[model samples]
Target: MQVEVISSVNEACSGKLQHRTAIVVDVLRATTTIATALAAGASCVIPAETVQDAKQLTKEGDLAGGDRFCRQISGFSYGNSPGQYRGKQIEGKRIILTTSNGTRALCKAMRADHIIAASLLNAEACAQLAWELRRDVVILCAGSRDSFALEDGLCAGLLVHCLRQHDRSGMLQVDDFGSAMEALYRNKANVIMETLAQSQTGKKLLRLGQREDIVSCSQINVLQAVPYLNGGSLIQRLPGTIAQTAAPLC
Candidate 1:
């Protein structure tokens, strides 16, 4: 199997992800928040490309959550922080989420055979699922403001590393950018939290008094909840929940 890493959402095109398993990473908060919300027992997450779209998608029982420039959208139920979703309030409720970069990246990956919301929190589970699906993979980093974000790149690198670990044949081919990301992961694996704290986005979060969020998103392989896109919603699944045999998109 082959794996390609997209540096940022702006660099991702649907054509590259056709018939492939796409793993969208936004570790600074978006994908991490999705996985956290699912692990916390939310029913499903619907990613929207815009705040207007997110508002429109919300029904009476649904919750609208998103952020712009790292601040909560006015009048939304919640912001993009994972901590906000870690409670009983989200149980059995649908989250209509839109973000500046992450949700846009998810929508950009809609052409893939399977789309999985990924972050450092669930990298191992996502790799295992992608390996089982037996499709070439594309890891799209939801960078901040159309530019590459260090935290997202680190998570993509972690995904690349995890995917290679599951390659039984040892023939997994990774693109040049993916290889570079793998190197980045190896070099900073020991100081992940520190690295995140030093990143540009990290500094911004700190200025906004969100240091806890950076700590939460930097943990590697801490969660098994994989947010698999089923139609317009992302439903939670575990590593072994999917059949090993290749199946059509549900």
Candidate 2:
């Protein structure tokens, strides 16, 4: 039940996460979008590290979505906005997704014992899942480029808080990044939304007139699904079900 937070994919690779449960966070949009999409009934999501890869998947007849910074790609069917997933007929469909930071972080965690994608949208669910597993956990934040993002850090803090509540013994270990995130959570109430409106990436979205996207991504725990990478596709773990199906790669 040790807990640690890595600021980026690079930091995660430098540590030992092979036997640990990995939680990938990209609160600015990507992970948030995935959680929202799955909650809205998407069958599965295929996360690609690059927009080019996502486009290629789409050209091969995959249902693809693309986002760089914040705006939609030229030929993408959907942008990275969580609001676009509601009531859509995504059930049993494969979503080829690419994003600025989150996808890369997810790819890096693919080798972990258990990899779960997290965001403000599914923070509590993810934390609860991690606690249930009772494994050492690494919270990886997909920061902008190689730098830290405040929104992701805040989400990590919320997760840490949740996990601590579930197990308050000395079993939980907090790293430097985790401590910083907890501090941010103490001072900044609802900072994920505010940071997105003012962050470098968030400002780019605003310039693109995607204020609605920021608002959508900023909403916390709106989804109950915990998306995990299984056999290379993102699938939701349904509650009360000991068995699950792996999403086929398109």
Candidate 3:
């Protein structure tokens, strides 16, 4: 198996991810929120790259969740916070999710053989599912806009660590972004919290009084389901369930 990490969605095109198993990361909030929703029993999540797209999907009969900058858009039912998705009955429903960065990354990876939405919340489950599928994996980080975000990179490193631990025979490849992720994980205790607290996007969240989101997104493996994108919908693959499934289609 081979592992590659791309920093932004713009760098990941259909040709680049063709026939490859892709893992999408947006740990600051979007991916984390999705994992939480699935863990809380959402039937599936349909990622939309734009808010307009999300609204259109809703008009066509999909439940819509609009998240802009950590806040729910006016007239939308939910924001990007994982806390909001909890304890709600979302089973047997389809969520049309649009976020600032994460959903766009999912849209970009739609052409991959296997596309899984991942975050620190479900890092271990994502890695385990990847190993079960036994395909070369590409970890794509949805950086803040077109630039890097420490939170997403750190989550990518955690996924790398999980994959390396479970499948030692596989080859691991780190890109510039992946190397930065490894470095960030190495010094997480000292720099991550403070750096995030001061980051441009992070500060905006702070001003919005969502400091708890930062804390929640940083925890590793709080969710047990690996949210995989299949046929334009996101499905959760519980641990010990993939082995019974068919071989990866790609």
- Give the best candidate by TM-score: 1
Clashing residue pairs for model 3: none
TM-score of every model versus the real structure: 0.97, 0.89, 0.89
lDDT of 3 by residue, 176-204 (tens): 66666766776773565566666666788
Candidate 3 ranges beyond 4 A from true positions = 59-62, 189-195, 243-250
Better of 2 and 3 by lDDT: 2
Q: Check candidate 2 and list the clashing pairs.
A: none
Better of 1 and 2 by lDDT: 1
The list of candidate 2 runs beyond 4 A from truth reads 59-61, 190-192, 238-250
lDDT of 2 by residue, 1-250 (tens): 6788998766778356787889999987888888878877787899998877776665443568867766687878888887777675666577899987899999889767888999888888898877766568899989987888877888899898878877755567788879888888767765667876877777887888888888987887777789988987889974334334422211
Model 1, poorest ten-residue lDDT window?
Answer: 241-250
Candidate 3 residue 76 C-alpha distance from true site, Å: 1.1
Write down the TM-score for model 2: 0.89
lDDT of 1 by residue, 120-188 (tens): 999999999988888899999999889999998898898899988887777799999999999999999
lDDT of 2: 0.80
